[model samples]
Target: MSRHLLLGVALLAALHSAYAGGKVLMLLQSEKNIDRFSSFTDALTAAGFTIEIKGYKDSSLKLREYGTWLYDDLVLFAPKAEGFGGSIDQQTILDFVDSGHNVLLGVNSDVSEAMRNLAAEFGVDLDDRGTKVYDHFHYAVKEDGKQDHTLIAATDLVDSPVMVGGPYKQPILFRGLAASVPSNSELATVVLSAPGTAYSHDPKKSMIEPPALMVGAAASLVTAVQARNNARMVVAGSVEMFSNDIFNSQVTVNGASTATANKDFCVTLTRWAFQDRGVLVASNLRHHLLGSEEQPWGYRVNDDVEFLVDVMEHEGGVAKPYKADDIQLEFIMLNPYVRVPLQHDGQGTFSLRFKVPDVYGVFKYFIDYSHRGYSYIKLTHQVPVRPFKHDEYERFLVCAYPYYASAASVMAAFFALGFFFLYHK
Candidate 1:
């Protein structure tokens, strides 16, 4: 089927498509406890998302219709399904994301290979089949004396406010397997990590050797990835964590009972994944002379120039100017000639003033901002730098007085020699 893919569009293009409550397509399993995630779906709806739920094997399921994408975001809640129905498949979902859409994937202990493949494509490696995360030290106490130690009360969240919204005051109940995220990956961020004493292994089997696969904080329970195109994806280990039961249940960590913070965290995560928060777009990139607004055709060596841009963060269908102190600009040719931090005006405008280097060539104004939990923004504007014209040079200079005197003396001597020759003849 033909797809109207939105590639190379401006950063605001995605936001504009989602400003009027973007459509979300959720694929779920019928046999599974679908009713459990009502709280999560309700939260997404409350946050201005038009959700359309479909069974994993629904024949009518289609991501694109009439050569246009039908949804702006997707939710994969059927982790055990081997493959999707109709025309939906792993590549279809990938293509959806490649076009700058969003996805929220939830996997369980019985996660299928297809789900693993999808997670792997986003740089998250799910543990082997039949294995689950075991946190004996921080396991939540069940009501009926069940000794299953897989229900973990994870508290090791990434220390990023933009990702998690804020510090989680209470523990999040996570009962699922563990995954690994690349430590050096700039696109992937570990949202939740297993406790230091946690390990992943087959609960039914005995320990033959120490668990080497995933252990401690290295085992990630939740990870978020923002692709280079600014498409967002959240890989969650436990689909049950979004259930209404877990959302309303209480979690005990170290014998202290506290209400689960899963609802708040899940809502925040959904909001981020669906582009309701932490989305940034830059506009009106302007550069001109220091004292004038008109941009010249080209810059001169050592010329003073001013640069300005507006950056806005969209949330709750409203756009507000982004405020930050670390946004920078790079004046570049083959290498950066000037790298300076822009000053914000309390609104969303960031401006900078600097003198052009004493070299003449092609230059570009580059802004590459990538903050945790926020959409990536890269803007570049190229302009030429011309050398001084002949008339532009100074007619007289104190440093060249000696050379001027020498040239004048030579001319006078030649004229005197001609006069002497004529008179002697």
Candidate 2:
């Protein structure tokens, strides 16, 4: 009986651990051994996540066979999925994130066309087959004193402490590939960039001329995308960036020895990718007449109106006010008739005051607040704008008084002429 009780307690402890850590589904493109991904999962485990490994061809990836809800988050480290033999289509992964889950995707050398297609759907692109980002000037030297330009050190991690956390402003090691983001495409942000001297091409071949595009800082070594549902996705150009070897390896750049910042980067990135940070929400919404307690029946063309909203950010499972410099309010009809900035009062209160637009119609009070490395906040309130009521109009019109007097005089003259004609006759 004592032994049985001990076993029961152990089972309960295991269950508690799994529940506390949060189940994560990690998918590999190839069915080969997964020893390479241990360090990647280790980083996440440190962040309180339990990683579940599976191959892309596994029966469990089927849309009907398995659902994305089985896990809290996903880490897809499939760089070479040519056919990706599974019932799980590209849309299945998107649907998973659309339901408010998060995903982290990594790509390495020999990027497959199938991966490119999937990335394109998410507004990101991967490099062609066998292409890697080679920086002859800034490549790190291996421990054996061999110089490989393909292995680079990137520092252009875009300015977002909330995502990068500590150990930011340091160089991260990259070993493979790069991508190009369209100048106007806003779905993805370049989190890490290759240096200006770097050009992406096959390292084996001698190039007569540099590649046309996907060069220099424009070549994105890593990017982060936040879906419309606030489901975050991180696309990395190199899978080895999250590997144990790279994390522990020392790098020599320009004959100076330094430790790689990849370990810290991997931890912070895992936190951000899984929604541990950079989450924001808005609440306590209030809007009414500028100086009155009662809500107006409707807003006139020239009415003083005030708008208020309480915005807070999510961190460490707590929501706190996110102080920011730019929060805007737009009074919209078919198009924006008025656009004004909201002022924060050192707390979470974002307050704004503006006269109602002269035009009267169905207007929406639109608050679109978005910044890099933060959750998006979009709030809208529908309100009707109306013309002045009959009683609300001015009692007297000075501009029309002269016209009114002239009309009265004309009537009097015509009546008197008719009276004269009748009497004389």
Top-lDDT candidate index: 1
For residue 190, give model 1's deviation from the true position in Å: 0.8
Spell out the clash pairs found in candidate 2: none
For model 1, give the 10-residue run with minimal summed lDDT. 1-10
Candidate 1 residues lying further than 4 Å off, grouped into runs, are: 1-17, 143-147, 408-425
List model 1 lDDT by residue over 1-425, tens digit each: 22334353544576566653589988887736557788888888887888888889998889998779989999998989999888899999999999999999999999999999999998899998788888778888755556558889888988877677758778889988789987788899989999999999986889888687599988999999999998999999999889899899865667777788899998898888877888897998998998798988889998999999999988777888899999989999999999999999989999999999999999999999988888888999999998899999999999999999999999999999999999996
TM-score against truth, every candidate: 0.91, 0.81
Q: Which runs in model 2 stand beyond 4 Å of their true positions?
A: 1-22, 29-39, 62-68, 83-87, 166-169, 204-206, 394-425
Query: Per-residue error at 402 for model 1, in Å?
Result: 3.0
Residue 349, model 2, lDDT: 88
